[model samples]
Target: MDLEILNQEIDDDEAAYRVRVVRRVHYLTISRKPTAVLDIDTLCRPYLLIPKLPPFPDGNWTKMRISQAANGETEHVLSWDPLDGIHSLWHPRQVDVLSLKRTADHKARVKEVQFDGRILLSKVAIFEWWIPRLQRETEFYERISKDHCLGSGSVAPTFLGHIMEQERCVGFLLEKIDGRHPLLDDHPACEAALRKLHCIGWVHGDVNICNFLVHQSTGHVKLIDFEYAEPFEETKAQLELQKLKDEFSQMTER
Candidate 1:
């Protein structure tokens, strides 16, 4: 992946700045996975250089300097005060370094790499805008990983670690469930998994069969895809639970 700086401009007051960057990813492999290699300048600096400007009485701006790399790659610099809506302007996405293994969707991609001599699965975003969604799913997995009741086997796979690039988290690694069989809608384990999630104050927003996997050898069922899973409110949780129950019952009758 190569990143080229097209243009950059800063305001006279040094209160705001914008940078245009063009990124290109040449797949050394035969796969057509979307990948981004960002050249972030300010983050590489040893310290932030704040320019002298009339300070807003209410807040202050965080100034950053982006230095150009010897390889002709330019960095982006931005300055904004949090109280003045910095988040709306400069959204920082977590970046990670991982090789592309497979492509999943328009925004999501999968990578398989050797970790500790074991092949693992990596879920990453193909574009910058998709980073937040992937981060949310990572947070959910991390949270549920600590629950003793759910156990590691009942979840999708073991989380290895996060992939970081330019001081941001872009993706995460997990154990590869290569040979698992898909679950049936009426499978008893599906209900049991949903029950466990609800008991732990979470609701698997999507209860389809594709999200549940059955290990071929062990026969242990694992729930996957927490992108839609969220904290269960009383009324909403019951409603979703009952809906899933009705769907499963109907499947059984059929």
Candidate 2:
């Protein structure tokens, strides 16, 4: 596909947003499934991508006919018009930018960047709905830090701070780990990490292989993506454990 994510302008009162982009897609060679090329920006610099959704046009109009001076059609750009979209702003200067680990989607975008002389993972939210989860996670780390009953060690990456863009708190930063996702052999360590969280009256609401990071040199397992996590409840904690068990079982079958 000859596609590139270009920034387009959609001004005037008709459209509510000033920025938008359509789409550039590439299909998997084997599956032929299309995926958006949202991470088209270069490495090391910071960017802010917000959701640009405008109000829909009033009518079930499918076809649009543009009129000429003699023809019977209105040549006006109304509130309802054909549009592509906008996202991911990239600057052309040789500036330090974060290495994109994943594209900016509605849920979240992960990137690697240099912050305070340390390489950290930046999980940023592109939409307003997801911003709360990042805020909750920051509070989660704060609570853990104050509690004296739990061990000093943390199974999750160290919480760095909030990622601000356009004067908005979108997400939080975290210590980047040099590790890979847990495999069948790493199941035991993964469970041990999960249990450690439960022992502290917290349930990692989302438990899957992807959320568990196994360290390279130490072989330590760490949990991530705590968007669904919450205070410990007996039933909820057991359900989270069962989710881990089920995932391991499926891996074993594979």
Candidate 3:
């Protein structure tokens, strides 16, 4: 698919935000899955140099739309109508909207980002887009930092945030790890870290090679993401341990 960078505008109104981009994407067809392959390098640069977003029609500040691109087959390549506003944001796993209370967990910042299929790119680029969205809310990030730095301990970005809908599934954030080699596929450090988490009365349902991060400075490994963490009774520890063992076994087999 051919997606040309057109124009983007960010309308920030408290908790509501609308990011509109005007661009010509070639393959938004039924047989073809439309992909938004954003490059990290392209987004790294400051957005001030880009052209200002076209003014909204009828001067309705609450809603803004952009005419993306025009094609021979269609009028425009990709376009979105005026997005009204973001309503109440939901917690990842909280079933009752009334229970969408923010957590009081200390040590790391937590925020939500869009996890829909519309955003697509390399893994790195995909991460780059989602990271900022989590950090954009100043209040959320600052609160967690006051407690402790969350995520991969030794400088690698920690994923303390989540994207759960039915259950509380989110990830966290931490300082970026630098110049560190990840642990070998089979290493004791993996089990040790999970042990630490269990001791803290937390259970990580998913503990694979990808879930752990190594701190190069101290050779310490950190448990980064807690999306699957849940409180488990002692009686369930054995079951959970078996699950963890099974997960590790599968990783080793692969």
Report the backbone clash tally of model 1.
10
Per-residue lDDT of 1-254 in model 1, one digit per residue for the tens?
Answer: 12222113322222222211122221110111122122234312212212211112221223333334457554444445221110111123322353333433222256566656677776655444456667667767666666643345455576667665333455677777754544343366666767777777788777766667777776667776676778877776777667766666666677
Q: What C-alpha lDDT, on a 0 to 100 scale, does residue 23 get in candidate 1?
A: 24
Task: Give each model's clash number.
Answer: 10, 11, 24
Indicate the worst ten consecutive residues by lDDT in candidate 1: 24-33
Q: Would you estimate the TM-scores of all the predictions?
A: 0.54, 0.59, 0.38
RMSD of each: 13.4, 12.3, 13.5
> Taking the tens digit of each residue's C-alpha lDDT, what string does model 3 give over 3-88?
23222222221111123222211111111113212233333233631233232233223232222233422121233333221122
Ranking by TM-score: 2, 1, 3
- Model 2 agreement with the true structure over 186-246: per-residue lDDT tens digits: 8789989999989987998888889999989889888888877899999988888889989
Q: What is the lDDT of residue 99 in candidate 1?
A: 35
Global fold similarity of model 2 (TM-score): 0.59
